[model samples]
Target: MPVENSRIKGLYKQTVQERLKLVAKAAGLTDEHVQALSNHGELDDVAADRMIENVIGTMSLPVGVATNFVIDGKHYLVPFCLEESSVVAAASNMAKRCLGHGGFTTNNDEPVMIGQIQLLDVEDFEQATTNILQAKHELITFCNDVPSRMIALGGGCKDLEVRRLNTHMGSMLVVHLLVDCRDAMGANAVNTMAERVASRLEALTGG
Candidate 1:
């Protein structure tokens, strides 16, 4: 069956159980989904511990909905789990006010990031900078050569940058690898590239 309408009248005025039943019926949710939603302690200590380093208990937050949001011409009831008061109310108010204009529109850009490699204790900063700049293509190729699913998906190292800095301890060189991460956050990929190119960078900088 197709969903004809999502605008439920006075859904916020209903009781918790009443609201759940209405939402479940409208969304064609199963009994298991409703049960899971109603249950409090869904995450046990073992699961929580595996998720994070601490072996302590889990914290709880109240879940509320901000209604009347129409993004890209589709209605959405956003769920927010927050401790601050009036946030849900404020969001709902703003969304309701904006409904007359066409709700919200969003644009996304291709994800790109820089991986920084810091080379300390450089004997000659000028020579080290020149050496790294001269080997820019090689360094960028080394980064792109790393085995990554992102590279296969049309994303990898784009360019290399060299910066020389003078500090209280000594002079150092910082190498930046510009990368296109595609859809991922790129932290792991960037860090891996930085670690793989560190020895070559050290040799170039004589640090």
Candidate 2:
């Protein structure tokens, strides 16, 4: 569900509970989501420790509503959760100013990211490039061999490319792994794949 009108006048003048209610209504938030947002620092010490190392504790930031935004003919009341002051008010004011100019428009391309595997100390650039290209299918298959949920959902390594970059240090081979991460950010998957396939790439390119 979309927000009907983002131009909520005097939204900052309201209390925290009032603003939360308004955000819940405009953003079509569920009861569980609303409860989680209302409850600050829901992440316990154990949970925070599991997330990262040296986890002293968890912290909470104030979430403010940046009102008056219309993008692609849709009204939106964006929420900003950070320590920086004046960001929410500034964004809200700017978004309101763009209301008369048809708001903001967008033309986004397909979501796809690349993982580069740099091969240093190569003997022959041409031979390495040829070798990698010839084994592109096998390399892609190897990268996708993992039992990843993303791969199961038809999102994984789609193609492979080999480039010979002539840096100031020397000429090295760079293998570009074309991966379709789908809905996820693809960092975890891409990083894992890169680390896993480094040995194989080295054997292929004699790096």
Candidate 3:
């Protein structure tokens, strides 16, 4: 009710700096606040240009703040740094409407990626393919044996596939390994596993 009361009383109608001042006052920083305001008010283009990239001069734009956000059941004051008009107002209105039903829910899947290793220079492509197929279990075990700490955290090589490709370089068999990385971005892990598997596969084929 306190939040609703603050909204109804126009306390939420103030700008961000004004609200910050109110917060500082509530936190008993009223006496030192004048110095803070004076310091901020003295900011000029020379310092801003040094801090920002390609800031030749000051650009005039209307700054607005949006309120009433509920993302994943948590309330938030969404800030939009833009010069575009009506975007913030529209987004805020939509967020308010969605809050009546329920807040927005976001979900992310486990990061999994596939890497391909192309093997060439083999005497018998068919036999090489068969050899890799038979060694599939060992390959998987080898991947798990290295005990990739990243893979251990909800990540590991899961499946393997063989592909036959006919390029100008001649026919080659490409091996694809699918890795599941629980919470990580997984790019580096997938790439490392792919390289390791490729080396082992080359050795198996006596390449």
Candidate 4:
């Protein structure tokens, strides 16, 4: 009779094959893992290129997780993936030095982004800018019309600025919209809003 080991917590008994399968599944590995497994036996000219994408080939980088970090007395293991030589070793040494003198502390600035709308071929530049400024309430309302949950967390458009400059293509005004993006990389959102605003500005300025 075979025994089944299914402990719910902490430690459980599993065969080597069972553990490997569990790890492979948990890691969300693709067919690449299968090929790597197949390549355990070295062969001359083993061409296994059917299992990956953009396979000019894959590159390897050394990854390290540093321990002994305490934030408000809570321990953390911060992992870093880097390919630079000796970076991992240097980080390990620095972390060791900081552990005894209280763990490292860090704070981040709120990720805010700026969107620019260039208004060219204006009828009356000053009046156009004034019109935009007078309609600030409406403009801000329109700018905050983002459809993402991250952007909708009261972090859409904050303010708008107008910059007048002279160029070879005549005098142009660049409208700058500052946006606060809570946790997302907001480049796409910023650019999209900028383009929309540019179109609206062109309509207003007869461009």
> Lowest-scoring 10 consecutive residues by lDDT in candidate 3?
1-10
**Cα lDDT tens digits for candidate 4, 30-94:** 67763453342332111312221111111232223333455544445443444344553455556
Candidate 3, residue 25: Cα displacement in angstroms equals 16
| Model 1: ten consecutive residues of lowest lDDT | 49-58
Ranking by TM-score: 2, 1, 4, 3
**C-alpha TM-scores of all predictions:** 0.66, 0.72, 0.56, 0.57
User: How many clashing residue pairs appear in each of the predictions shown?
Assistant: 0, 0, 1, 0
The residue-by-residue lDDT of candidate 2 on 1-207, one tens digit each, is 369999877666555566667778778889987777656576553443333322222246555667788999999877665556677767878988999999999996655678999999999888888888898888889999999999998999998788888988998899888889989999999988888888988998899
Candidate 2 lDDT score at position 83: 55
Q: Write the per-residue lDDT of candidate 1 for residues 78-156, one digit (tens) a residue.
A: 6665556667667877888898899889888768899998898888888998998899889888888967899999999
Worst 10 residues of 2 by lDDT: 49-58
For this target, which candidate reaches the highest lDDT against the unseen true structure?
2
lDDT of 3 by residue, 33-135 (tens): 5344324333443453233221212223223334456666666544453445567667767777787877578898656778888887777777887898899
Query: Model 3 off-target regions past 4 Å?
Result: 1-12, 17-90, 93-107
Residue 20's lDDT within candidate 3 is 47
Stretches of candidate 4 off by over 4 Å are 1-63, 68-75, 81-85, 97-103, 166-170
